[model samples]
Target: MSDKKNENGISRREFLTKGALGSFLVAMGGATVGGFALPKPTVSPGPSRRYKLGDPGKFPVGTAMKMDKENIFLFRDVEGFYAITAVCTHLGCIVVRVDDGFACPCHGSRFAPDGHVVEGPAPRGLLWLEVSRTPDGGVMVDADVEVDLGTKLVV
Candidate 1:
């Protein structure tokens, strides 16, 4: 009866359009606030690790054992004990120790017993982590810290 619609007399199209506009505005406002309120993602080194691998004497000389769960190879040569990462340098694939050396099944990368890359596609040698004896007499491998080549933990 009048040019102005009565209260509660909104057409379905008008109602939907207004609702959509309101939703869009609310979403944009929330996004703008969130852009400033949300914390920015940070690039940082991972936390330090000190993994205990039990008594050092458990590993014997001339024995090479793979701790698959820890992604490390505990080796005891006639000289001493050492640790080499089982992770392939090429694509982070876990390497398996063969008679000759370590091999990556994922991308055909090969590493020597000393963790040196003997084949292509690997950028560098496998990581040699820092190994030390804890006060509790357990052996600890610091995966977060890599030591120089030929570094050994002689028990």
Candidate 2:
């Protein structure tokens, strides 16, 4: 309240104001340094989503093979070859092949052989991935690419 100066020749109000300003400047300096010291925002690359399943002839017709590492089911029907993701749409759990369809062990979600949702808890059907024949006569499946339910690669 008083404008009287202390022994240091600075008034109480001036001392407080200077102290507050110094603190604010120091805090801002530290924040700026911290921002610069932090690593730059970046996206690290991930593993490729494409997988090569050797010779289409190796897969017998009517064969439904599960690739555990890839989390996909490769099917070779009479029509052609198609791939379905084994990951459950409900909670990302791996689905197991059942007698009539695929069943999720974690949440009881079921999907038909064609990847259609047969039970609830899952908001959508399984993902049908893009399958294509490579230049070398090998079959490849792209898990990152989604295709229509009935889409198949007739090699």
Candidate 3:
């Protein structure tokens, strides 16, 4: 073949290169525009860390109620209400409530009734979550917020 220039004074190889570059630029521009056009989420996307357990009266004093779905145990004592995570500190396994306290079946980690580490393999004791009373006299627990041990919300 002959190395002849096209009508636009560009050779076949130059034309092909320019075409490829133009296509790439157009594709990138479209992607940018599409990204900008996408709607932004107003709220974060994920499972909520805060749970509202309605009616403080529902949880009577001197009772320990386990919320399996939220992986937390709610306790209401003579003083007030408190929450502790049921997840084992060692391996994130669900701990079963025993007569004495809690036990992890996954790796044999044990916790006391007050969530202090009783057995080995666990780095620390169970987490104590923040418990608060809502404006409507409802109980709310925030799993994401860890409070000091033995902290109770006196409602």
- Ten contiguous residues with the weakest lDDT in model 1: 1-10
Q: State the lDDT of candidate 1 residue by residue for 15-96, as single tens digits.
A: 7789999999999999998997766655555655678878877877887888777888887887777888988888899999
Alpha carbon lDDT of each predicted model: 0.84, 0.91, 0.92
**Where in model 2 is the C-alpha error above 4 Å?**
1-41
Query: Residue by residue across 1-155, what tens digits does model 2's lDDT show?
Result: 46799888999889889999999999999999889877764665789999998898899899888998999999999899999999999999999999889999998999887878998799999999999988898999999999988998897
Q: How well does candidate 2 score on lDDT at residue 41?
A: 48
Alpha-carbon RMSD to native, per candidate: 9.1, 6.4, 6.8
lDDT of 3 by residue, 1-155 (tens): 34588787888888788899999999999999889877766576899899999998888899798998999999999999999999999989999899999999999999999999999799999999999988888999999999999999997
For model 1, the stretches where C-alpha displacement exceeds 4 angstroms are 1-48
Candidate 2 lDDT at 103 equals: 94
TM-score, cand. 3? 0.70
User: Which structure among the candidates has the greatest lDDT?
Assistant: 3
Ten residues in sequence with the least summed lDDT for candidate 3: 1-10
What C-alpha lDDT, on a 0 to 100 scale, does residue 37 get in candidate 2? 72
Q: Estimate each model's TM-score.
A: 0.68, 0.72, 0.70
